[model samples]
Target: MRKAIIITLVVLISSFVMAQKPLFKVDTLSIELSDLSLHAVLTKPSNIDNPPVALIIAGSGPTDLNGNQPMMQNNSLKYLSDALVENQIATLRFDKRGIGKSVYPAFSEADLTIDRYAKDVRSIIEYLKEKQFANIYVIGHSEGSLIGLIALQDISVEGFVSVAGAGNSADVILKKQLKPKLSAEYFESVEIILDSLKNGHVVKNVPPQLNALFRASVQPYLISWFKYNPAELIKKINAPVLVVQGTKDIQVDDEEAQLLAGACNNCSLAEIENMNHILKTIEGGMQENIQSYSKPSLEINKVLVDTITAFIKNYSK
Candidate 1:
């Protein structure tokens, strides 16, 4: 089944690879917000000074700096950072304000919104700016792609890359992913709640069974999220855009990438064959595909790394 559209309730288990005299130097960096700080892991080629850097925004959920969610320790983002650094570029992966090591004494999920997430990205960008990187790019995976689009509106970057990101708004995508499994009545409720959220309203009459997906506490976040449409937002970006999709991805389809590419100016579309949502290569049924999500030892698709490396290096300063 396709994944549902909801805040990911993730576990935090991180995995790391050890290498002596590693070509890259990894550091824990952070940026301060009003009452909290956001943390990130920066991996840069040790031999290069102020190399071009990519702010790698992870997908939704409790995903940490290593792209891991509790039981699933695939380290998807970590591998991406490793690959880029191996090719002489730097990458930074951050944990959201309340996730991973970004803890606030008064952290509240009720206070979270898509705009808030974008602001976090902006904060990280400002921090990166002071570091004197030669150039910078923003890469967002899954939900992070939309967050990147919203954040890029206020900041200028060398380029942007969207991986496994949805092309439509949260409301539209959610309705589609859920309609197949829900009963007729449940599906109707889904539509009603989504429509109300899209209109910037809170839904209080959520069915008891559907409360988990539309609980009162998360409605504000949903209200802010439903307002964004990726296709519409992509049109406003001034930087070069790369829309990446994978053939084996069960979460997002290829048409979504095409929707983004079609709307973006100075955009390039890369449809990677046999690549899954987590950016790993897969060649099997649903069971085999899902198993790959937990395999931290498995490397991500090489073409994905090469494609991004070439794209970022093309505009290297």
Candidate 2:
């Protein structure tokens, strides 16, 4: 009986050790914004003397803090947060106003502008400040990068990290990315739709054939997004910036990274080979690249993590 008890205790202790434990505990907070209650996830470091914090902003679509879209169920940001926490970095990630557990009163794409997201970011920054956080960083992905740039105009962040961020306007990016995948005839049609948007025309009746190409939910956000150029914004930012891009990213190309790098007075770009838009290493063709988005088994490259950690640590000093 004593042997059995010893064996059970050993197993219990081993289980505790083997279990995946978060380096930090995630705290959820609700902040009142206009007529909505915004929800944010604050990951507090386990052992630190009030370490600097970072606010993580998700990309386009209905992406949550965990980097999971409604259609794409894999949670990449969860792993990212875990990785960051392992490095003793506290992070805050949140859902957009109308998504996930966040409050929504029929919020539409028209209401989703860079300004609105900036406002939300400002609110979160204020909340962090109230918590006595001395230094705050902003890490933005894709569309969130634009929002982060806009947020800088209002809030004072210690530093900024742009992950897979575009250096051009949304319209330019859309045309460049989508045109190659579609037929030349269909591509011209897309240009016409974009031209209409550029002229500030509300598209009420998209042709039935273009339904997949032009989503109603994406239109208004696109309209609001068309007003800003990321390169221009990058130039105006006074804080030290890190531009992390993947060479294999199909959405935002190297040219975009170059444009951003050229515009920034105090910015450095780290290009990760074989890494895709979602920060997963892609080894195959187009289909394989898209498949990586849903594959959580694919881990973010170690070099990328090391680079970021080293950069942050060196810059923090």
Candidate 3:
């Protein structure tokens, strides 16, 4: 009876201790921008008192806080947040204005400039600052890298990470992406449209097939996006920067990472092998790589995460 009582007491005590241990928590947050409200997901370690925090900016074109677009759903950013929490770090990932929960009908499409995106990030960084997070970092994936770099100009942070960001200007990147798929004549038309937009003029003669990418509605935004070169902007950042690229990424290549690393005086580069644009490890052709965009089940490349973790930890030290 005494032995059994002792065992029961131990089990109860163990259960109590386990219950006392806190798990990571998530909170749905919002920041107001004039008439619109930007939606965000804040993830943090439950036991951490003043954990280092990262502002995770998603890529372009309607990517949500979880890094999903309308046609595809993937938890790339969500997985990244969880990984950060596992390392006792806090993170805030948000939807860009006019994307996901931030899409308000009252907002004009013309307001979608890279500057606006940078301002939104700055707003969040200011909020985290108010919350007393001593160490703040920014991680931008794809187009978010450009936005984050721009944001760094206005708001200071400990470090910045660019994942699969294009080093060239938007016009140059677009031309490269269209070269293989477009006919010679159609390619000329693309050049004309891009040139007009580069000169701050909108063209109404958009080809039917190209309307989705270079439509009149998006021209103003494109004009704004075209003015900034990622390489040039990255050179202006004073904070430590990490340029991360995947070897198998179909959207971006190693050259972009190299260019970015070369531009920044304080920068480190990490190229993950077999990792695609969505940060998944896929050792296959283009079809298999593209298919990974919607596969949320696959985790981000561990090397990518480890590289970021080590970079931040070392910088903090």
Best by lDDT: 1
When summed lDDT is taken over every stretch of 10 residues in candidate 2, the lowest stretch is: 308-317
TM-score of each: 0.92, 0.89, 0.95
Steric clash pairs (candidate 2): none
Q: What is the C-alpha lDDT profile of model 2 across 128-245, one tens digit per residue? A: 8998888788888888898999888766778888988999998899899888889999888889998788776777788888876567766776677888899999888878898989
Error of 3 at 101 (Å): 1.4
Rank candidates by lDDT, best first: 1, 3, 2
How much does candidate 1 score in TM-score?
0.92
lDDT pick, better of 1 and 3: 1
Off by over 4 Å in 2: 1-22, 212-218
Please provide, for model 3 over 73-146, each residue's C-alpha lDDT reduced to its tens digit, 9 standing for 90 to 100: 87998888888888888889998888888888887886578888888889889999998889999999999999
Model 2 Cα shift for residue 139 (angstroms): 0.5
Q: Between candidates 2 and 3, which one is better according to lDDT?
A: 3
Q: Whole-model lDDT for model 1 versus the true structure? A: 0.89
Against the unseen true structure, what C-alpha lDDT does each candidate score? 0.89, 0.82, 0.87
- Please identify model 3 stretches exceeding 4 Å from their true place: 1-4, 12-22
Clashes of 2: 0
